[model samples]
Target: MTNKLISLLDYENKAKQLLPKDTWQFISGGALDETTVLRNRLAINQRLLQPKRFQHAGFVDVSTKVLGSIIQLPVMISPAGSQSLAHDQAEEATASASSRVSTVMVVGTAASRKLETVRKVSNGLLWFQLYHHGTALTEMLIRRAEIAGYQALCVTVDVPYTITAEKDLRNHWKLPYGTEMANFTCDEAGLGIKSNTADARQYRRPPHVPVTWDTLEWIRSLTTLPIVIKGIMRADDAVGCVERGVQGVIVSNHGGRQLDGQASTIEVLPEIVRAVGQKCEVFVDGGFRRGIDVLKAVALGAKAVLIARPVFHGLAVAGDVGVEHVLTILRNELYEAMALCGVNTLAEVDRDLIYNCPSTAPL
Candidate 1:
């Protein structure tokens, strides 16, 4: 069955069939109207690669370092909350898959398994993704991650309020029973979700501690781990992150789950990269289903790209093997793309490798 899974879409299709209806809707749907979801893919398609075929590209080397961590490819798993919905093994299976490929995995704050369990099961690098619940909760989570052997702290700063995806609302989805965010004391954590009406949904928002540019310094003071700010799209925000001592920035739009009409992550990648790529590592994620999309991000100056939905699709279809297969397929596709573009190493990928047709068109 895995042999027939020729593309990432294949896994997506298979996973859709395998997962429960409410579970699939929660994982697949985006914000209200979902224009952002469509925009994410449309923006990526707009940038065409200027392949320099027949340059004796030879063996392609996709390995590179992202914020001092060595990954086998230019791809890393994005942090997505509540993994048990996808599969029973949850984040543990994902950790094993990442370790098998020697890439990094940013364990979500709402992961089904505890941070220590993920760290103990996987041999690869782990970065704890911090969603601020409060000063105390944030500090406790960070300290736990440090003790559990995580490599860095990726602070997700975009979600100021609870997200309200239409599909989730229509389905009245709630966090599955027995699923608890393992990073904190179950009673003190209070990170689990419960049912609520559509209008009252935003009002009954989860425990998302508000954070701003000022919060970065306070977080930095809490731990010595390298800070990677996620959910930054604007060039000024990227610049601000670098100026404020951040080690990395992830150019993302919350996988089109936050704002419904905002620009896609790919559409905003070049500007963010230009603003802070030199000073701090720039990463991106959103609508990146193909290896070619990964190549385009690197060419535009991203240190690496993160993938979440695709991996979830893999997990829903098969456990650890499914996740591993997803990574392998993407890695192989990226290799083919690199060779076709006549680039032997990630260093050879640059702005010249892509032709922005829209930018060159007559205004």
Candidate 2:
């Protein structure tokens, strides 16, 4: 069955068929009307590619570096939580797949596997994704990740509070039995502390600690690892990240899961790239489905693109093998797309490759 899956969408369709309806909705649905979710794909599709016909390139190199770590391709796995919802192996399987493909996987704070346990399973670049629980808990998690041998700290600054999508609320969605936030102990997560009932779902409802730019500074003070700020959408905010000595900015809107009607990440990638201006690495991740999508982003100056929901699709379909297939599909598609566009390497991809590029137009 896994061998039949040819594309990411194929995996998605298969995963949907296999996963429970409520779980599928929780994984696929987005915030409010899900307007931004639709817009993310629309905006990427709207950006036209200018293919150069004459240049004959023998081979295309899709490899690139992020935060000084080399990857075989520009596509990477984004930090997503409750992966156990998709597979029992969960983050361990995802981590193993990432290693097999020679890419980075940002392990989520809400990961279903313990950070150390996930690390022990795979030899690959792992960046711990941090959700600010509080100063003490945040520091503790950071220290744990550092000791666990994670290379960087990807602090997710967007989800200040738990924003449940309409579909999730409609279904009264709850974490399935047997899956838990393995990173947090029941007591540390405040599970059963108040009600005396051990509800694992309490892990989703962490204290609302607003993550401001100052919060970045505080996190910086705590870790020697390079910091990558996720969920950045504005140029000024991206520039602020540079000022604070942050190493990277992932231009994401939380996969349109946090807010609806916001500008898509692709629509804002070029500006964020311009604002950062090589001060730090810039990456974008929203509505990236095909190789052409990856090419469009790289041409627009993104260091790389990260993917989230698709990883779940692969996991649900065939565990680690499906996850590897998903990454391979994108890498192969990127190679072909680059050849069509006469791009032999990521360094050759620039604004000129995009027709009427937004980066060059007057704002």
Candidate 3:
């Protein structure tokens, strides 16, 4: 009844209480000691915002270009699997929510519904997330995604090997009934099952070949959809992706879901941008909870930002409406920050608006 549903902070408070404890831990917890997870927030806090003087103090814009497409805002939905856990709508509901907000939503390969169904619900731009189980299946999904009106192919390359979260192990977390891997029926071993338990807290590694830079050439042979390489953190990898003729690259740490000790995406954005900022559109994801956070990433040179976890929280609390509210909060916060910082557009926001803070700032 209060103003609690109006902002992201209040939504966060509600989602924690609404979702199952194990689900909450799995969605929010990072791998290992979660050093990178905690550090992600700290890294953003350390960024010092530099304010400009009274110059052209009017008419601010939030719209920006990403991968040759003009998006309403610099925020995007990072491709994440297991949305069915949060709502009955799952991918379809989440996609529709993104449409309501005019933001981009990247659909995961492991979604409960296939890309064809997802495109039908989403009103805004769409990008299909690929975690290729094999070439035949990969080409099948890619072609289907393109056929279904997807604008791009966002290939996730970070999780070749899956790590079972201990939290899930403790809670016996497993995929509920009616949800199955939509892309392939089974792994390379001919085992139709993906998880060892009801919650799928643990999974055996399938024999899919390691994803490498050369895989780009293989992908190029399959479809014409713009290929966006996600889950890159190192500058060299960013440069390599550009050189490989990738249309876009998302600098991410897998939402702190994979490795735990790596540097936060914000801490590495500047260097990655320097390395490949000019070659292609460089986007970033990780610890993007506020408008100031998005501003920090942009000022550091990210073309845009992607979000995970929060979207799930929104879905958990209020389905599509909750997702809409979550994105609106971030978008509204970003606009306010831009106005206060005296920037009229994304390009106007440069490194001048941010510097590393001495304390809590990464050393």
Candidate 4:
């Protein structure tokens, strides 16, 4: 069954069929009317790639580095919680697959597998994705991640409060019984619950502590790991990240899960890239599903692009093998795209390679 999955969309289609209907909605649906979700794909699809003629160099290299970690391709796995919903091995399988492809995987704060347990299986680069639960718990998770040998810290800043998707609310979606938020199960951390689910309709929400620049400063004081801020949607906010000594910024709308009607990550990537300039590495995540999407982002000056739902789809289809195939497909497609564009490496990609069709032009 896995062998037949050729593209990320193939895995997504197969995963939808294999997963329960409610679970499918949980993975596929977004906030409110999901206007941002649809726009994310539409924005990317509207852009045209300009292929150069007779400029092939007979080779194309998709490899690049983020925070000094060399990756075989620019695509990295976005950290998502409760991956056990897709497969029992969960993050461990995803980690193994990232290692197989020589790329990075950011393990989420709400991962079903403990950070230590996931680390034991993979020798590849791992970055811990943090949601600020509060001072003590956040500190504890940060300490645990550093001790567990994660290379960097990615702080997601956009989710100030939990917003249950309308689809999940309508379906009354909840984590399956026995699904443990392994990191939070420790009594020492002050969360005594076995699982995050407290009721059929509600799950634990990260405490809504007001995260100010002071919070980033405090987090900086806790660990020496390079800090990458996720969920930056504005140029001013991105400049704020750079001003506060952040090492990187990911232009993301939380896969359009946090807010509705926000600009897609690709729509804002260029300005954030221009605003940040060479001061810090800028990356993006939302609505990226193909090699061409990745190329468009790199051409717009994104250091790399992270992917979330497609990784979940791949995991749902065949665990680590499916994840690897999904990545390999993108890499092969990227090589083809780069070759067709008369480029040999990511460094050669620039804004001129992209021809923004009139329909997608910003007003």
Which candidate number would show the highest lDDT if scored against the true structure? 2
Ranking according to lDDT, highest score first: 2, 4, 1, 3
Residues forming the 10-long window of minimal summed lDDT in candidate 2? 188-197
Please give the distance, in angstroms, between residue 338's alpha carbon in candidate 3 and its true position after superposition: 0.6
* Per-residue lDDT over 1-363 for candidate 3, one digit per residue giving the tens place of the 0 to 100 score: 224687766777788888888878878887877888888888888787987768546888888987777888899999887787788888888899888878789998877666777888877899999886777667777877877889999988888777766777777976555566543433432335453344233222234455786676798777888989998888898787777778888988887788878988888888888888888888999878999999989998988999988888888888888888888888889899999888989889888887546664442
All models: lDDT? 0.85, 0.88, 0.80, 0.87
The true-versus-predicted C-alpha distance at residue 193 of model 4, in Å, is 5.4
Q: Report the C-alpha lDDT of model 2 over 1-363, residue by residue, as the tens digit.
A: 888988888998999999999999999989999999999998888888999887747988999988998899999999998898999899999999999999999999988887888999989999999988888778878888888899999988888887878888889997765455666653334323322236544654556587987888988888789999999999999999889989999999999999898999988988999899579999999889999999999988999999999999999999999899999999999999999999899988998898985654231
Query: What count of clashes does model 2 give?
Result: 0
lDDT for residue 22 in candidate 2, whole number 0-100: 97
The number of the candidate with the highest TM-score is 4
Scanning candidate 1 in windows of ten residues, the lowest lDDT window is 195-204
TM-scores, all candidates, are: 0.93, 0.94, 0.91, 0.95
Taking the tens digit of each residue's C-alpha lDDT, what string does model 4 give over 1-363? 887878888999999999999999998889998999998898888778988888788989999999987899999999898898888789999999999999999999888888888999999999999988789889989988988899999999998888889889989987777565678775434555555455311323446665679999899888899999999999999998888898999999998898998998888888999899699999999888899999998988998899888888988999998888999999999998899899998988999898856767751
- The TM-score that candidate 1 achieves is 0.93
Enumerate residue pairs that collide in model 4. Answer: none
RMSD of 2: 2.6
Clash pairs detected, candidate 1: none
lDDT for predicted candidate 1 compared with the true structure: 0.85
The digit string of per-residue lDDT tens for model 1 on 327-358 reads 99989999999988899999889988888586
Q: Which residue pairs show backbone clashes in model 2?
A: none
